[model samples]
Target chain A: MFGKVVIYGVGLIGGSFALALKHKHLVREVVGVGRNPHAIARALQLGIIDSMASTPEEAMRDADLVLIAAPVAQTESILAAILPHLEPQTVVTDAGSTKSDVVAAARAALGAHVAQFVPGHPIAGREKNGPEAAIPDLYVGKKAVLTPLPENAEHHVERVAQAWAACGAIIHQLSPQEHDRVFAAVSHLPHLLAYALVDDIAHKPHADLLFQYAASGFRDFTRIAGSSPEMWRDISLANQEALLGELDAYLAQLTTLRGLLAARDGAALNSVYANAQQARQRWIEAIEAAEAPPPPPQETSE
Target chain B: MFGKVVIYGVGLIGGSFALALKHKHLVREVVGVGRNPHAIARALQLGIIDSMASTPEEAMRDADLVLIAAPVAQTESILAAILPHLEPQTVVTDAGSTKSDVVAAARAALGAHVAQFVPGHPIAGREKNGPEAAIPDLYVGKKAVLTPLPENAEHHVERVAQAWAACGAIIHQLSPQEHDRVFAAVSHLPHLLAYALVDDIAHKPHADLLFQYAASGFRDFTRIAGSSPEMWRDISLANQEALLGELDAYLAQLTTLRGLLAARDGAALNSVYANAQQARQRWIEAIEAAEAPPPPPQETSE
Candidate 1:
């Protein structure tokens, strides 16, 4: 699908894309760009990249695609750096968690070449990070969202979609605004809550004892708290408005829950829990149905 | 350990206790008592109980041990029902999630015979419920906390501990007050938060779309919300004061987090996330080390 690809910040998201493309013979070469020479060297040693690009100019030469998979804070700088080197034919995209911020950054940096840029977020995240954590099938069966710009050519959007498809991702598209709002409620809010929970528990006087008693439920509930701090910080800031909106909504929900508990209203409390339980049960069933393999064709009863 | 063992409310917790005891040969006869005749008959059919007791009178006749594994709200009534049939040698214990409430219930119902009542909470909850969900090994390697009262005999507490130990649980003791407070922070608070989150998302106008996008992180974060609503509702009320305290503390934490987001302090945000990440990482390590089989005896290479 691609002859050569340049990926900035070749960590889990970027490296995984590289491997997925290569494994399917979709991309001939993967050139990794990073400020840290040590990390660049390690990615090369790990065989996640075909070569190291010391500069965007070197990375973009003969490259058909450029993917900025760095933290959201770095997207602007990476876009600016690549702008000077981007070829007319190169279709640029990103794997940023937040789309509105990345869209703004690309518009400001790419100028006339903004049409070449396509914004995407592959809704696949793990607590683990860095190059070694990348897997070839990381995007398989995951949602890869694309928020295309008005200036972008139809062919460029198609090119980005095809690349993700090659990685076995299911593609969906939405406007930048809707993407941020939806993710703010579902993804970003959960991450912040998880982080807040862990921070709160960790700071208590008997934190050691509290943690000692935190069993499987706590482990699962707070697993996202173990994600890369710098990356999440960037995301939390970049998507601040939407995220804060979500926080307020969640706070309101909790306040209502508190009231029920304070009043000792067992019926109301049970109703809330039962509603949540039914919704979650439906979700689990949907997931299971999707994951179950199709049954074999039945024979004719001649 | 004794001839007759009567268990009120033969659901997951109660049924599992019966199977665990019978599996280990710690008890000779297990008598099931329930308001629902079908459930009692099912327990007997499952071989979880040696016989079904239609009433507390029948259940408590010559019973050496009585375990109230019903909902916290029902504990008092069950205690009262069994009190009329209590034998001087019988040891009574409960498996409520909250300790202080159970202690109060025992005090009210058992009166002068409260010395026989030992309050315990097995931190072995699953999202599933009912007699069908019972498992013999559910409490194995889990913490079974006993909150012995001042009125209780030491041997009575020991007998309660021995029963849980026979079920493969590691027993710990705490004052009822301390147990409720700690659990309010670690266990109950998480359950409320999980329930609140799911309820919030499930109520949105675009709830279907939102749920479609909800991924693995959301799955783990909301898993506890799938728990039995009736059971959790009772727990929330029983542990009301302590749970409200934890909820308030959590709200304050969220307020601080909101302030950070409003200010967009990237460094501060990163620090909080990093602290939480480190604490959670430490917790995961501790749990793993405990779950891991003990290292093979160190080599004595001469």
Candidate 2:
């Protein structure tokens, strides 16, 4: 529990963190800070935050915790801006989609106090963005991956984990390299594929006709294409190496599929599809099992 | 209105067709036939059909309409089996996902009676299968694309269109070639991409970890992967040429994306994402517009 928390970039992630902490009575006050004053004002009006901080110094004053939930592109700048005012007692973390970039930014900005920062990425969100999209339950039954740096003190990292745990999230730790690699396969690659499909179709002469006839399958497949463009671009660049590796692997998979199609190998094609169907079916079953998100990792390896 | 309807598959599509027809009181009786006698029995027991027919001959008797909603692989066989029993008054149609192959099968098997067969693809479905998955409103507010043969009599095609209309589907016409091409771009390509992504991840050594971290985006993106593998295999081969073309185009699009990533061209990458986001947003808005499925096509091109 914290007496005061500062949430910079009071959009969906920041706003939701504020609400989640308050929902559990885990914090006495939530101070909001953002480059867009109007958004901060809206957060206050929406009861998402108790107060608005016009400056990083003002926001950091007596702040027990600082959650930088801005776009990954602003991670370094925000960290640098708040570093001068950061207190030794304050534990800092971020909800950025990419971990290695955030870790690098924290190291570059926090100097000797870099141990105060714990890199985190919450695997929860909706297609909508901004403060209005924030929900107290966004992280409930969800996983928050923390990639603690070598310099991070154990207690500081634990505080960050506890904060996410208070928000009903199940905390897991992965090294920055592993986090980037795993997410590159599961998250980044799929986002790129969705965006590519939509953008490719949109560039066509018959794009309208294609979109018009697109039914439920198309709707769900391309839903992620509707995500924030700027945010995805930042994540894409930050994790470029891992994502490109994934794209290459996926392209290879497509080539094998093309070979099957070329040969009219229905049996082979069916096998591939059946394998995917089984795996995806199992994944859905696990998701719908109605059991809560897995309890805190049995015996933290870290 | 039909005096009696024969549905040869009794799976999701055929069963839903029966339920929808009965729901609208547009048919006097619905007869089901399938290789799976148990499923056919279930269809009758569930009231999705009024009777079970052991053979095409039995089902064809007194049948005003025969809907061959079986897998695409069985198209020619079903057409061959039913041709002798298909009466002059019985207009035949199919609910296959691919049009060109069904048209070919109709020509090869129906011969002179091919004119009675109208190729159609209902632009709707669920991930579930079997008679239990059928629903009366499955086609409500959905578009059913009918690729009418040039040899078909206008009245026969009209009867087929009327059957779908009774089930709350809006009818539109396209040449078999056009239908396959457009669907390859919109439907088939997306399904393959989804299946490919899931299969690729499933094949990896860290598959469990990747799947564990996969959230809502991956779930929606891969939802189609859980579809019947045998059915998709048939569709892929049936619409092979068109699908391959679309796949090539998508591969090219992915190459462009790879270039953007390699160059770290964040601005261009953002623009591509923004374009897709805008188009998808507008399309979703149009779908959400309070108005119903576009009232039957402006004018029948045929």
Candidate 3:
């Protein structure tokens, strides 16, 4: 898909992209940029990328494709730093979880050339982080949402789709606002809830004992609770409005549920439980039908 | 440890226990009793049990130890049916999730003989069920709570504890009430919440689209929602009071959270998120430290 590619932040997503590029022969030369020299060295040693760029600008100097995979808050600053060095013909996109901020940052950084940039979010990752956590098939059968700018070139969008396709992603197109709203419900909100649930249980009087008794159900539900606090903090803040809206909606429903249970309203509780059960079944069937393998069993050999 | 062991339910728990008994060299013979003749035959064919008994009465005729592993609602009826057949010297016990109900049933059915019937709950299982999901080390490093009758004989209690110890379980003696309350927070209540969450999402106007965009986080959060509805329904009904209390409490907290999010109270939201993150981390660390290899993943070698 491209001759040379530059990834600005080579963490889990970035590192996995590098691995996928290798798998599909999508790019010939891979350049990585990260703040930590140790991580850069590790990525190079692990063969995640071919070389390390001394700076963001240096990374994009000879690259045909530029991917900003930094934290959402850092996207604007990094884009600012790399824009001056980018070739006019270069194509740029991001692998951020949030879209609005990144899209706005790209517009401000590239101005008239903003069409070259596509804001995208790959709906795949693990609780684990860093380049070491990157796996070869990280994006296999996953959804990658692309929010193309009004001026985005058709060829550029096509190339972006092609790159994601090579990485084993099914592409979905939406506007930046729609992408943010959808992800807030599908991803961001769930993460926030997981974190909140963990916190609620941890601060309880029987915290240690409760944790001791936490079985597979609790472990699975709260798995994302162990995510990078810094990254989640940034995401929670960046997508605050939509995430908060989701939080409120979930809470309102939960409150109504609480009332039902308190009143020993068996019919109401049973109705909700049955509905939830059926919904989850349909979702599971949809997932299974997609023929996507689960991320390898946790703590098992990948 | 046991010469003739009778398991009163030839399903996942009983069958797995039989396999574990053989694996640990704790029993000479495992006699499985089930209402379903086909399940009994399947259990024997799978080598989960050495022999099959058509009725609990037949299975307990010559058994020195009897473990009832039936569904919560059926425990009382099964106990009543098997009580007359149990030898006075038999060390009877149960592997039910909800202790109080099972304990009450044991007391009602066996009267003074209840002292021989220890109510136990093993905190382990897989999403999959049946003898097919049976693994010998299913209880290894898992918690097994025993709620013995207050007048239980020392020898009977010690025998039950030893049996669990042989299966590599960490045994704890708990009051039935305590067991129910604790598990309500850690296990039952969480399952209820998961089912409710998934149901709410499914009923949403955009359910299909929401699911299409669903990623690992939602999948993990709602994983328990895919659990056997029949089993959970029985559990929820059995532990109704405590589960309802926990659910109400959770709902209240969720409502408070909604208020904070609706107002975009960043500080409050941050506190909730941070607390959850910290709690989840501690819980995971504790579990990892205590784990002794999860009995090998049950990957069917297709």
Candidate 4:
């Protein structure tokens, strides 16, 4: 699908994309660019990329696509460094979690070539980081949301969409603002809450005892709290407005529940719990149904 | 170890305990008691009990041990119903999540026979309920907390500990207040947060989109929200003071995080996330170490 693809900041998401592209034969050559020479060398050794480059200029020499797969906070600097080296026809895109900041960074760095950039976020990752954590099928069965701006060329958006499709990702299109709002509520807010809860518990006087007695429920709820601190901090700040809105909404709900508890209102508490339980069950059923294979053809009756 | 063991309100915890006792050959006979006749019948059919009784009085006949594994709200009623039938030698205990309330209920109902009761909580369960969800190894390698009162006989507490030990549980002793306070911080608070988060998102204007975009992180964070609403509601009310305190503490922490976010204090945010990530990692390592089998005997060169 492409002659050569260059990926910046070859870590978990970036390296995974390179492997997925190679495994699917979507690109003739995968080139990894990173400041860490050792990580780039490791990516090459791990077969995550066909070659490695210390500079984007060398990597994008003959590239048909450029993917800025770095952290959101680093996207601007990466774009500034790579924009001058990019070919006019090279369709540039990113896999940043926060889209608005990336879009703004593209506009500031790409100049006339802003029409080539597409902002995207693939909703897949693990707690582990680095190139060694990369997998060829990481994007399979996951959603990749694209927020293309009005300045972006239609052909560029189409090319990026096809690239993600080749990686086995389902694509969804939305405005930058909408993407930020939705993700802040569903993804970012929960992560912040989990982190806060764990921190609070750890600082308590009986933290050791509390952790000792914690079971599966506590483990699952706080699993996201173990995520990369730097990555989450960047996300929390980049999407501050939407995330703060979500946190406020969640707090209001919790306060209402506290009021009900103080009033000893069993019926209200039961209703709230029932509502959440039923909603979660429905969500789980939907996910299961989506993942289930199609039914086999029925045998004919003679 | 036991002649006849009677389990009241046979469900996941109760049925699992029965199976564990039977598997260990610790009890000669097991009897099931519940208000739901059909559930009792199902338990019997599933071999969760040797016999099914219509009332605790019939089940407690010739019983050496009785386990009240009902909801906290129902514990009082179960105690009231079974108090008149209990023998002074019968070692009675409960498997309720909250301890103080169950202890109080036993005192109110058992009167002079209160010394026979031991309050306990097995820190193991699944989202599924009823006898169908019961498994013999559910309590294996899990923590079983026993909160015994001063009014209870020492022998009764020792018997309860022995029973749980036979089930492969590591028993931890604590005061009722300490147990409630610790659990409120770790278990109850997380469950409430999950429920509130799910409920809040479900009521939003873009709920469908939010759920669709939610990936593994959100799913794990909200898994506990799918628990039995009636069970959680009863627990919330039963341990009202402790849970309320936890909710308040959590809210205060969140509010402080909000302040940091509003000010865009990247350093403070990073510190919070890093603290949580480190603490969670330590806790996970501790659990793995506890659950891991002892290393094979070191080679001896004589």
Query: Scoring each candidate complex against the real one, what DockQ results?
Result: 0.83, 0.80, 0.47, 0.92
Location of the lowest summed lDDT over 10 successive residues in candidate 3 chain A: A258-267
lDDT of 2 by residue, A1-302 (tens): 89899998888898998999998999999998888888988999998999988788899989999999999989999999988898889999999999888888888888878889999999998999999999999999899999998888999999999999999899999999899999999899999999999999999999888888999999999989989999999999999999999999999999999999999999999999999999999888877774556567688668
Pick by DockQ: which candidate is best?
A: 4
Instruction: Give me the displacement of residue B183 in model 2, in angstroms.
Output: 0.7
The CAPRI classification for model 1 reads as high
The CAPRI quality class of candidate 4 comes to high
Model 1 C-alpha lDDT versus the unseen true structure? 0.90
lDDT tens digits, residue span A117-157, model 4: 88899999887888999998989999999999898888889
Cα error, candidate 4, residue B124 (Å): 0.2
* Candidate 4 segments exceeding 4 Å error: A298-302, B299-302
Of 1 and 3, which scores higher on lDDT? 1
Fraction of native contacts under 8 Å reproduced by each candidate: 0.81, 0.88, 0.65, 0.92
Interface RMSD of each: 0.7, 0.7, 2.2, 0.5
Estimate TM-scores for all models.
0.96, 0.95, 0.87, 0.97
Q: Report the C-alpha lDDT of model 3 over B138-254, residue by residue, as the tens digit.
A: 888888898877888888999988988888889998799988988898888878777766776777787788888888888888888877666776777778799877776776777
Ranked by TM-score, the better of candidates 2 and 3 is 2
Candidate lDDT scores, in order, read 0.90, 0.91, 0.82, 0.90
- Score residue A5 of candidate 2 by CA lDDT: 94
List of chain A TM-scores, every candidate: 0.97, 0.94, 0.93, 0.95
DockQ of the two-chain complex in candidate 1: 0.83
